[model samples]
Target: MKRTLALATIVALSLSLGSCRKKNNEPIAPKPNPEKPAPTPGTNPTPGTNPTPTPTPIPAPPTPVNGDNNNTIKPDESPVNATVSIKLTKGARVTIKSDKPLTITGAKLTETQHTYEVTNESGFGIDGDPETLDLSIAQATEFALDKEMPSLKSLKITTEESLKKLSLQGAKNLEQLDIAGAIADEQTLDLSKHSKLRLLALGNRPDMIGKFTTNLGKEYPSINSSNPSTSTSFKEVSLPTSLEVLFLAKAYCALVGADNLPNLRAAYIYTPKAELLGDLSFAGSTNLDRLMLAYTSGGGALNSLTIKNKPHLRDLFLYQMTIKHTSIDGLPTNTLMYKTTNYHLPSIEVHNTPAVKILSLLQIATNLESADLTNNPDLTEEKLVKIAEKLTAVKGVNLKIEADKATDAVKDAFQKIGWTVNK
Candidate 1:
């Protein structure tokens, strides 16, 4: 029995030894593949350190004069002045203070996109009597009292809401008036009392424009108010006979039958169009000198810019801006000494003007001593020289010509005009 048991145990021991060797001899399993690569130590990008950074958002726009969006006033806010009293028919940001010679500019009272009912709007209700107190619409519905308006020399009612019956009656000493955008609820405000008025700019006041502008001659002797957009005729807008210098821009006045501005010396007109020939006469002008038309783009041609009447016509400045054009015709050939006057014609400036003619008399520009030709590219050098050659009697003329490339054409013109051409 002992021998059999030893033999079995020996067999069992041999099997166990073989199994242990097999397990020990097996190779270790290869490492499994990772999903994502591991980052290098200390190589991560910070928020602002990235090459492409995110942009910051922009802030909102600020509020206006009478007040702003928030009732709260900020440190960088603009202040209000004392000379100009502000009034509003809406909620806004406003700053109020005292000033001298009350001048209000840079504050634009433009039409807003939202059309809130003015009368029903919280800030739009009409306030107390102007006879008793001047008004201000700075903080919502706050009405300041006890302060009387002092004598004002120049008053500008730029905002429509600020125009009140009380204010106009009070400003007796006002000389230069620019109530351009204002509107009075009452259609008529008797301005016949403003007898001392010299310059008035009430063009955009559509309602009261015709009433006052037409009879300006009777009310304010020497007036400069422009004809409104709504005014159909200038029957009432007669320039005062005593007027010396007249400046009218974008106004619709009849120059056709208009004649004999005898006392006028300098006339400046800028409109869409103008025609001065038939009844256009400026004779008997003792001291007339300059005629300038700026931005006269749309207008009828002056077949007769008759200088026979204006021997004193020294400077002619015409800048064509619109599709229409302007001209100086009927210049007398006997216009001698018109260039040497105290305020003589420095040079005739014509830009974008069409149908230019280098007549025998216009050739007197050779004596111009100094000629300026810019933007009048049509006046070629050859043509200019042809005109300059006529002034052989006058002393050497100083000519100025600007063109692209300073071409041979320009050089040839200078040569013909007896100018030592300078490259």
Candidate 2:
């Protein structure tokens, strides 16, 4: 019995050892209640599981500096809309390319720089009161005037071609115009619309041949017709009725009928061409204050000078004119005889007038204050004495006679009457 029991204990011990070895060789599982989740391969930790960090911002660039060290605002070089006013100096050359309106006031413009050159394709508007305006463009084509310039008073155009492109329909306040070098053919410049225009100067061009027209109702104050090289004759030109001053130098025209110009105050006519100047009668210009006629070397002879009933004619200047005869029939006889404070006495000036017998015309000018008859070889001492005696209203006179014609007896007689005689 004891031997059988000991064998059973040995078998039980062997079985226990084999079971322990098999448990150690098999795989094992992880715990189900873990503290944190597993990490992702290419991502951050879970948002709720970890704290986030702050980010840094980028900086801006600095302002550029100029060489002068001044904070001057430069003009926008691009062809964009202008937001500020443009201020230009005298004789400043600048180009503008804007599609907006511009105002040129007196404070913003200079007299020497009145021209506005627009380069953009769009039309612009002009505001404010500018006294003078000269508009030009790169192309010689007609442009549009968007608005009226009422304060513009004077306008000067460099060429006639430019004048044709401009439309003066809006510039109603223009007064003075200087178109000195306009050379156009067969183009009539009509200024009848300008009612307030006072002065018109058209000189210094030879080939400027075109019909000029003005209003018959609105007479101009002054007209300068002094082109020397003009060969084109005008078809028809109407002179102003209230013309106060007139200048005619080397004008190629027929006899100017001064009978219509009643208010003529002063006139200067000088023709050096060999063309004949027909009878220039001033019968209608009775209130003529001063008259100067220079028909020198190559000019035509004075066919006749009619001073018939001129009562207010004070001064007469005849230079280098050959007067054959005197027409003083209807002149007032001793009309200006009495020296009065109301009226000025008449004065005569004759230089190189050899043919006219000056003594014959002295009877008409009895109240003569002065007489200058120099370089006249046709006058004799006897003729001068007769002229001096006819001046019965004047006790003394300022006389300048020819050197060769003044004799000693003539000098003594003139000196006795307090007359200044230059020999």
Candidate 1 residue-pair clash tally: 23
* Candidate with best TM-score: 2
Deviating ranges (above 4 Å) for candidate 1: 1-236, 254-263, 275-279, 282-285, 296-304, 321-423
**Which residue ranges in model 2 land beyond 4 Å of their true spot?**
1-112, 115-236, 254-257, 273-277, 301-303, 322-423
Across residues 1-423, which tens digit of lDDT does each residue of candidate 2 receive? 898999776555434422433332111111122233343223222122222111111111111121111212222132222322222232233322211234422122213333333323332233444455443222232322324666555554333232223345565555544343333333344444555443333322211211111210112212233332222222222344444344444333343334666756555554443144456666677766555455435455555565655655433445445443334433332221111111122455554432233543443344456677776665677766655655454566677876777798677667666677875
Superposition error at 142 for model 1 (Å): 25
lDDT of 2: 0.40
CA error at residue 56 for candidate 1, angstroms: 54
- Clashes in candidate 2: how many? 0
> Local error of candidate 1 at 160, Å?
9.4
- Position 241, candidate 1: lDDT: 41
